[model samples]
Target: MKAIQAYRFALDLTPARERDVLAHAGAARVAHNWALARVKAVMQQRAAERTYGVPDEQLTPAVSWSLPGLRKAWNAAKAETTWNGGRLLVAGRRYPSSKTCSGCGAVKTKLALSERQSECEACGLVVDRDLNAARNLAALAAEFDTAGSGPVGGRGADRKTPLAGQAAAKRQHGTAFAGQTGTVPPQGGTTNRVPVQAY
Candidate 1:
């Protein structure tokens, strides 16, 4: 059996390269914030529609917050910036980038956003939090794509493009209702139903 291993090295970037990298990071942050805003807006709209007694079919649909979902929206909006046609290496939201130590592979129980450095109790190693996370992520990608073929596919790329002018499907309503018993009429008629059970 062939064993798999990975390693990461710190980049010695020129001043200009450092600046360019920083700019790209800033752009990524902006894109993330923008996607979050869109998701939140759709959620708020759906909530408001439900409060206004809008029919389930008539309510504005919800947007996905998954990496692929966010990537799709980001790709659609990429034209707004100079970053286009680039492969996106999105780590899973639940991946503990900051909590894992790159030196000894010890996982921290808790890490706060205010802490700028990661101190591993097991290894007694002090590393800049963000740099440690970046190293860990690079190793993760290396291990995930063992062949070093190219960017991993079928995550964001394979998702079906949402229809234009139509919102994504609303998975659930804020107003909780049990036992899916209501069905829309075929001839476009409203049916009187029991009030929803609200928390």
Candidate 2:
């Protein structure tokens, strides 16, 4: 016999900690909803295409529901959203802009909302929080320009889905299994091999 053991622990969080936890949960909910909406839209489009007699190969590419797939899609969309005109871009939500130092590029482990200014320990540069964040974003854009690479949206010009007629062919119409007539008797059995009649 095998035995299984389980343990549960309760968390006692402070007000700030509780808020942080809630914020993370809210962010997760938003991501989930966004992915769900994308999936639903694709499905609806495919269904509509089917009603119009569009072949399977012509339907929209299916959205992946796996965690990594969803994460990749989310990252691409977030990158596109933050992108502005040439060379100027805003950081995505995941970027710790305000917590990052514009002078030395050092990132603080924690930055409270009440902190209006950012002070870097490495370079000893003190600046307004928002200004520091903006500077960091500008630096990122400059780095991209120097590297001869545009932002994420500018790259990956290829279509995410397959082109028309590139998808797998539709399944053929027929019985999928070989035992449609009924079970066969053993080779040496005495029972007659009469085909079973369907009602």
Candidate 3:
């Protein structure tokens, strides 16, 4: 199996280079805000039509809020915004990169947007806000590389089932709790297993 890897390096930018970087960052922010505004406008328009009892087919066409759609819209309007060309990279929305400790898998429950630097309690690593997040992203990418394109082991492998008419892989429900000292009652009229508690 092929293993993927990534490396990250911190840049030491000259004053002019730093200014250019800041300019591009500002442009990216402007583009993102513009795209969000456009998406909101379309959504509001659709909602207004619904209030007017417009037929579903006759309603204003819905627009996608996905990155590609936003990128296309931004590209068309960037000229009007008077921003010279700058590539906009969209990071994943879900990762709490800035709030996570790059040195350890520790997550902070709360972090304010105003905090520009963070000190990781777990590893005593103090880093700039953006650099810390960039490091975390690099770490995440490295982890994904190691996982590779293969059937994962443990819970994932256990959860999989053979196609219809194929022989059972082996009853795993009972096996999951086989090491427990106490006896578990049978569930759903099937093999005995520990009851799964719903959160």
**Steric collisions counted per model:** 0, 0, 0
Q: Compute each candidate's TM-score over C-alphas.
A: 0.34, 0.30, 0.31
lDDT score at residue 195, model 3, on the 0-100 scale: 49
TM-score of model 2 (CA atoms): 0.30
Q: Which residue pairs in model 1 clash with each other? A: none
Q: Write the per-residue lDDT of candidate 3 for residues 1-199, one digit (tens) a residue.
A: 9764422222444677556655655556446556777778888998999999998978766656556888888777755433422223345898899999878868888889888987888888888989989988877655654324343421133343333432355545654343445554565454533445442
Best of the two (1, 3) by TM-score: 1
Estimate every model's Cα lDDT from 0 to 1.
0.67, 0.66, 0.64
lDDT of 3 at 126: 84
Please tell me which model should have the higher lDDT, number 1 or number 2: 1
Question: lDDT score, residue 140, model 1?
Answer: 83
Clash number for candidate 2: 0
Looking at candidate 1, what is the lDDT of residue 188? 42
Candidate 1 runs further than 4 Å off: 1-73, 76-89, 147-199
